[model samples]
Target: MTGRRLTSLLAYVTTAATGASLLTGCGVLPGATGGSREPVTVMTWAPDQTRATNMPGMPAMAQAYARWVNSQGGLDGHELRVITCNEQNTSAGAADCARRAVRENAVAVVGSYSQNGRAFMAPLEAAGIPYIGGYGISEDEFTSPLSYPVNGGQASLIAGHGMQLAESCRKVSLVRPDTIAGDKLPGLLNSGLRKASHRSAIDIPALEDAAEYSQQADRARTKAGREDGCVTAVLGERTQTFFDSFRRLPTGAADGDAKGEEGGKDGKEPAVRISSVLGSVGQPVIDRTGGAHSPFEGAYVTGWYPEAADKSWAPMRKVIQEHAFADNRVDPADAGVQTTWIAYTVLKEVVEGLDQDTITAAKISHALDRGARIDTGGLTPTLRWKYEDLLGAPGFPRIVNHEVTFQVVRQGRLVAQKPGFVDVGETVLSAP
Candidate 1:
């Protein structure tokens, strides 16, 4: 459909959607009986059936939060009804879902899967709906007032972790897929490394396929001097290719034999440490590197959510264990589940803080600008909203400054090298 026509249709739908609330001066309908209440609907991209099972622990997490809100009497007796639809991981599908959400009079949206959330940004904004959750990394969508990013963007996370790496390593190499997420790594790391007050040599290869990463890894290993210099590697991938490539590379005595002993022909071996930003394939990376063939031994990774063992995340853990855990479905460690919890909590906060009985898109937007910090005990960083500065934006992106600290597996289990928490510092991007 044409943009103008689509815009007009959306406006009409939005009007119809909120007509009853407008007339009643509240979400409830007129002449409603005792205990009559308007249901606060939360829309997400995951289809109801699929989300309940496949997408990590989010369904349980969401349901747990819903139950918690309900137990607290649910936003002044208005019960929250979560309505999920599958965006099918496509922009068009996500936009269609957004339209449906407005048509259903959803107060806000949460849990958009990956770029699908970014795709729905325009429509959600046009429909005057607000959203929370992290998926979109693009700057344009993140800086907008209508959309609040709870999990933080990938680019920003990379920058933060890169800064941490620069403090200990002198040479850095990035191995990533050829997707949009992969493409943004070099620029993001370069900017991040500079801010950390260190200069490190960087290597980024254009990997069209995961198998092709072997060539890139080989080059990175050589440039990093095998095991002598303080070299760090940053890898990004959504497929098993990254893990496979890294595992295939020679390591330990085998590596020494293939490339000659330390200082035999190529001089001293380089002290190479590998690290990765959170990707869709993090589990595989952890699993592969934890085995005997582990290539990521001694590596560090940055992640959005805290692991289950993080002591700081005790509160969130209690909630998840008591309410979210059911059967074997919910895994709180999954980034998506943690993100959903944060988004739901933020939405609840905004709704409860409203002074007026009725809620409007404008009002919700305003509450977010006031910059509320949500402390869910440290499973994630304290989430805060920053107002728009002189840049003429509504606000700085909503940030959950949590970065996970993990050691690459040399043996079977993961070794904790540092405390895992969100990093909430302002990321200053600069020239590499």
Candidate 2:
């Protein structure tokens, strides 16, 4: 069969299986049968060996959370089965995974790590499945109710951070990848900075189409230089190329080496800081850039998870270390894993609250819309659904009563530079 034909046929099969599973509750059918117990299937990218190897802590963190959930008696006495698959970072793989989850009769699907969540979004919505922890801050994903995003929107983070920076400097330079996520950040940052003060100059590079790092970095540095001391913050990935270009610039070098005295030639060196709001996703790459090459000493980043210093995260951290990191011998740098775990926890709580023998997509949606709040005991912020917010958009519902925190990466380690959580207020996006 042709590829398109095959995909359509598979989708049909999956729909049929899902229907059967909802009806029979028997294990005989492909996706049918929760098998005597309610099933909650988590679909996330299988650990990428290349990325995981460099960051050995992630897989372990995911495993720990899965094991802990199973030990906790699972959702409604049903053992949770985590069905992870590698998407190869492709849309096709994500679509296939979404179909399989629905076909398999999963009460709720939790996870589609990174931007790959975009591919499964439509299918899950069509299937009426509730999704958690997948969509980033992309405008397209912000309007969908089928998806529940635990991580605050990326654009919100960029805007919040940019507003903070605009306080110190009037000029800002944004360095971002050429991807959709990268493209959206600059606009968000500019909007926020402009709101804070009308004098801010935002310089975004034209490297969206560039193929090589050297080219992108050169362009970014040129923009940085023109701003002079007025530029206060440098927001982007702290890659080796970024640092190399930044250090070559007279201002960057002076800021890095300057003691009590100012670093720039004019004794007014700009505060050149680099940030990647995605945190752990950017850490490995940041680490690879080498401390000598990339000095993030005074740079700040916005992250979804709390810093290790936050005592609030103790319970979550303990669980990860004891169950997830114990067998794997990994540290807690895998922010994605923690996010996945938190998403699953919320899903389990929402599902268990249904108090129904059999679960349906409509029922699950209702429970979430009722403003269910899953508390991770301060390990993470509270995630609650506001159905009223759902009416405004299509993707994940806009988070209400949410808090944001910022951290600085100093000497290759993340430090909680900001004091407490700052409320960004409600994020209401324009219709897509």
Candidate 3:
């Protein structure tokens, strides 16, 4: 479809998808639920494939959290049973996961990642199971009243990149997939850049699943690193491959090298910087590339939460070490895994707040919908979702958290560049 047509379709979907939760009647509550002793069942899912952007660790993390929680005699005396699912990164698979959650009568779906929003969301919404802490890949996560997103998803990432680059870049280049979802990148990125009085980035669309992006990388590097230029890639898992190709090409004495427009009087040049969002670049990617020696060593990364190395994550790390020692499925630093941990934190708090009330999908959604404040141990500001929390951003009314953290890779670790959340709420709500 043409760009105009795709844009039009996205706009329509945003409108039709708008609305709060349906408050569907009770489907099935857990066995002996609210007895102050029954297990509170929940579902966690992600794509776990050898050849895709698999996040087997997400569900595994949920399992680990369950083990840790139950070992402590459960949350508020309620046993936690977490069911895992592999969405296979397909629409049909995502739908199946949702159906299983409904059939299993889960109280909530936590911290799962999937691009097939339409396939999965409708079933859960119909069943009244609140989707807490999704990775925000699909717009539906924000549009659906059932979805309680802990992060701003891609919308904030792209806009935050523009905000980050606007400060130092004379020009910017964005390398993205040549797909419908990707077509939204330029507009979102430009929203922040234009806000800063900077020119829009040059959009560079490339083959999503190609073997190598050498040509595209060359173009991006030449355009972005020319002087005070910057290039940021957001091609999901393929972003690493693009940058690998980007590294192999000799890009003019490296960035910040002498002889460029940003050259210091002492013969040191201020070359363009490279950047990406959380999923594409993280601790795992850095370690795989070469740690301090990795090409991403100096790269800027925007993320939904605090850095993995932050002291705030020590509790989560300790949980994984204590309970998930034998499980390679969970990575302590993977955003998918971290999100699962936070989602469970929210679940634990809400469940405990129930006091003696029976726990059901409807009850859970109602508590969150009516404004239940969840504290994430400084990982995020207190989270509450009332109508006032909504961003009113077209198609994404439920984005209560438009704040993204700026992170940088240092010596193989993801660390905070700025120690607090940067609000991109206006940037996103104002996007073209």
Candidate 4:
């Protein structure tokens, strides 16, 4: 072969081996292109190998979704190309990811996870890129005009968690990260409690990346009282650690001798029930901590979406089984992964609605703004982004889905405590 042909062959072999495209900051899926349609590129970013909360599954799921869509002759005859980045759980890293998306000319940033929303949102907004289906950890996800969040963000989860606890918990203690974002949780929780005439939860701020939360756990236990009291932590990855410390307390000796994974028979020892949101405590966490014998056996978990076992997730599971079976990082049960799936669903629908030969970030945003109805196959309410459809809640006016599901860990599985979604738009509006 000639020199030019040999060099091109070498580049092709290297690209196939690494699964990266020649396009800057992109990893095009194998066989993602079809027909004569132009490929629509998007980006997904989440923290990995971080001291704080990491959502490696979010980006992994995005790639898997792209593969599945492309396998089915692409989305509306247009190839779906997904570029992933590690946000590193820092402001600088988030800004870098957004800049990369801009540099790569990504039409949208879909189904991504990042706590530093402000850092990322500015760049995407400046580039006129629409952000879809964020994991809802940051305030900017709800407040930014360019951000089309699929969920109500952390604001709804904490508020809905307070409502879920109000039904059974006589006294509630909340242990959260001692950061600016954490400062808003207490008031949101209290607002939901007031709906049931319940008193405010005792706010206990703790380090988000602490190795162990023994001191905060002890304080939470003390503040929660003995009977019908509940302790809820929203410390992301450290939530499991906090619960571990909570269960190892001297007061838990009464239930120590229990055999098998069915440990929490009549609820936790010392009678303080544990609780948390879906992102902090999930099926993966429960399975890791001993399934049915987990410290969260009877824990109350508030979630933006339905339980993983719900039939609504059948499509997502199918995609994962086919495209991401070898990739262990993509867990269908993970909230971050689930959010990415929903976000991409929105992207596909919005793109199809445009029905244009050329797709652009401005066009996608305009299509969403003009009320492109997105049905997430029952995972969430039919999503629409019209100006009138927004919840208009304080600090989260762009929130369209104020519904949350109340879930419980039973026999190593997270199941719905109540059927259907509970609308917390009113509670969120009442928050300080």
How many pairs collide in each candidate, listed in order? 15, 9, 4, 0
Answer with 2 or 4, whichever has the higher TM-score.
Answer: 4
Choose 1 or 2, whichever is better by TM-score.
Answer: 2
Give the residue spans of candidate 2 off by over 4 A. 1-36, 46-60, 135-137, 198-212, 226-241, 244-271, 280-294, 325-331, 356-361, 379-381, 389-397, 426-432
Tens digit of per-residue lDDT, candidate 1, span 300-368: 556666553567556556777777656354455555666677777777777767734556666776777
Order the candidates by lDDT, highest first — what do you get? 4, 3, 1, 2
Better of 2 and 3 by lDDT: 3
Clashes of 1: 15
Distance from true location, Cα of 350 in model 3, Å = 0.8
lDDT of 4 at 306: 93
lDDT of 4 at 359: 90
Can you tell me which runs of candidate 3 are displaced by over 4 Å?
1-36, 250-270
| TM-score of each candidate structure, all chains considered together | 0.72, 0.74, 0.86, 0.90
What is the Å distance of residue 364 in model 3 from its true position? 0.3
Whole-model Cα lDDT of every candidate shown, in order = 0.56, 0.55, 0.82, 0.88
- Candidate 2 C-alpha lDDT tens digits along 1-432: 899999999999999989877654432223222445555555554324432112223334545666776666556655556666555445686677778877877656664453555677777788888776653534444656766777666655666666566655445556665565555656666655666654434455443223234444444444444333222222232343444555454433423332211233453433444444644234554455564234544456666667755676566667876676445433444455556656666766776787555666678777777788777666556777776634242333455433566776666666676777765543324212
Residue 381 displacement in candidate 4 (angstroms): 0.6
Clashing pairs in 2: 21-32, 31-103, 31-104, 46-85, 64-324, 143-394, 143-395, 144-394, 144-395
TM-score of 2: 0.74
Q: Which stretches of candidate 1 lie over 4 Å from their true place?
A: 1-34, 46-56, 116-118, 200-212, 228-240, 250-271, 279-295, 304-307, 325-329, 355-362, 370-373, 379-427
lDDT against true structure, model 4: 0.88
- How well is each residue in 1-432 modelled by candidate 3, as lDDT tens digits? 999999999998876655211211121123323343556889999988735477888999998998888777677767777898999988899999999999998999998999889999999989989999998888899999899998788998888878987887888889998876788889999998998999989899987777898888777867775577787888888888888787666634544332222122353333656888998788888888778667777678889888887788899999999999789878888988988888889899988888644578888889898999999997877888899988888867888888889888766678888888899999998898
How far residue 207's Cα lies from its native spot in candidate 3, in Å, is 3.2
